[model samples]
Target: MARGPAATPNPTVAARDGMVLPAAGPGTGTPLAVRGLTVSYGENPAVFSVDADFPPAAMSAIVGPNGAGKSTFLKASLGVIPRLAGEVDVFGKPVEQARARIAYVPQRASVDWDFPTTVIDVVKMGLYREVGLLGRLSGARSTRAMRCLDRVGMADFAHRQIGQLSGGQQQRVFLARALAQDADLYLLDEPFAGVDAATERAIIDVLRDLKAEGRAIVAVHHDLSTVPAYFDHVFLINVRRIAEGPVATTFTPETLQATYGGRLAATHLDELAITGGA
Candidate 1:
């Protein structure tokens, strides 16, 4: 595959509040690939010289400690944030060319729950690229949005105010919005954070279904215990790529220690059944 130029600050992406989409396309090659990716904020770089690949038809997790730049890497790879230097490709093409096939679910904390909008209306936003920002949601589009909400088990809450829902409900609404896009690759930042076990299971089940249908699911996940069970591919990082590959091989005790540094204790490792200490 050909390498693309380093991603720069994209005012269009920034202007859209980091949610932009184009017409969907039939993607080819790897789902996502980044080489020498670097992102800086102030004197220090949040992510530095990282290289990684997320395969198609699999659920992959980017795991690391707090402040490890896991989110930064995801944002930069998608050009949601500016990259100092790196090449990012989606399905063998530049990310810019493949925006249509990508969908992003940002952290729930980053969203303003206070926003005055209905759950169904929020999901309808995902169809903006198809229906135009000001275009009215026709019956078909509205029905599609409702179906997405139904898939996330939020159909009953469709008319409810977004702020009026619980944290887990809010997360499910966002996931429904992403699902409305019907993209080939889903980039989720902490989809399981702050959600109840039922919601987590619901979200993972939906994601696994997407994978079964040949879509890619890449998420920035924090829970180490669920990594092995929920994800087939794991990318361990600490501001840089630590280890990446199948969960069985790359998510070992040694890599966990390296990725988390001293933050991962021996008891935690034993609990994870990795058979080693930090």
Candidate 2:
């Protein structure tokens, strides 16, 4: 999972597939793309003129140090943040036109874990589009939601109150909600941030399954160590587009130094971890 070089914002291939998974049927080479994207708060710009393309049926990791605008970029793509001057397209359509095919798993801190909701209620909430306004539930909806819970190993906890679950279990419930969405593109912000190794592996497996099915999965990741092994592509961002490409090339020490500045040196341990070393 350790990376090699650093370069301009472009994409490359790593670990091509021989037998394609049924979920991903050779998605339209370019499923998501952005040009001159910028997001800001009040008078400050979080992202600036960044342009990048994400391939269909691939796993793309959006990475950077704190305040690097990785999550902002994802939000921008989804139209959550205000864009200065840019365009976002999904599955060959403008973002708004393709909203139904998009799913989002915000950072854990963004959710109200103590909202007094049951696991089944939370998972079923994701079926909003299918349920329309009345919030009605059919036998099929319940069945699918249960299957999604099972996929995340949460079927046993299906009836438990979400507030009582552990941090990792809460994260899995969010993932299960996204799974219930059954969309084409998934945007996850720090799904592994506070998770244990086992939860991380379980989340990774879910992501792998999504990519295999040809669903584009983009995660805003802070752990530089796991990018190489877990993602096919990465966008090394920091207020500006630092580098974008395969993890093998975009995650070099030079790039890390550029984005993290003084903190780059602190990541020596990260470099070692990426390379299978101590």
Candidate 3:
């Protein structure tokens, strides 16, 4: 596997808004790094040679068209799907070695909501690493799970069946499950899709809180209008990476045009200019 330059020293402790973040690990300054990542479906390539660096203590948005392989990039980097070629580093270590420090929230649409499980049980799934898959859910662990649910305003529905909840509520529950993991880096796929505005606001607020606590957040975001307001870093991709850097500089009209190709209408570009000052 390929590797980047030697890790540099970072602060042992980070304090923000009266909350002390977890001490940094040996090489956690960069939460995630992908080099020459490529994935394919037989003869067709999904994402090709994508390189990205996700900064710690920041929220980064991955944006592209529907078939641009945004989700493929995330899945391939995490080893969830087979990659033709690439290297993924998490907290300056191989992804396998850093699994405990990362949390993933897959797209809600991809989940089987009809599964016969209660909300609390679903949240407890996040604790499998610490408690073991077949271990009993003790009172303390249950309490912790409830706390995570409460953070997403779903504590009252903890006893309800997952499929019984609304779309927004289900999304919140998934996020709560991810929170229960208490990981240093969070990777979410289309977290705000198919949800109400209030749910979107709540989700973003929690993500911002996590960011303020010095956690790294990376999400496959589709709403271009919200990119400028919700993300500090932006990576634009269409099969391959078009541009990546701070949103203020990299998320310009030119990059958007390049990423979307002819799919983007002139009016949408105009709207992005007015809304994002791109």
Top candidate when judged by lDDT against the true structure: 3
Task: Name the 10 consecutive residues with the lowest summed lDDT in model 1.
Answer: 5-14
What are the per-model numbers of colliding residue pairs?
0, 4, 0
**Residue lDDT tens for model 1, 55-145:** 9999999999999999999999999999999999998789998887899999999978889889999999989778775777799999999
Whole-model lDDT for model 1 versus the true structure?
0.89
Off by over 4 Å in 1: 1-26, 274-278
Q: How much is the lDDT of residue 168 in candidate 1? A: 92
Question: Best TM-score goes to which candidate?
Answer: 3
RMSD of each: 9.7, 9.0, 6.6
Q: Residue 249 in model 3: shift from native, Å?
A: 0.7
lDDT order, best first, reads 3, 1, 2
lDDT of 3 at 256: 97
Off by over 4 Å in 3: 1-27
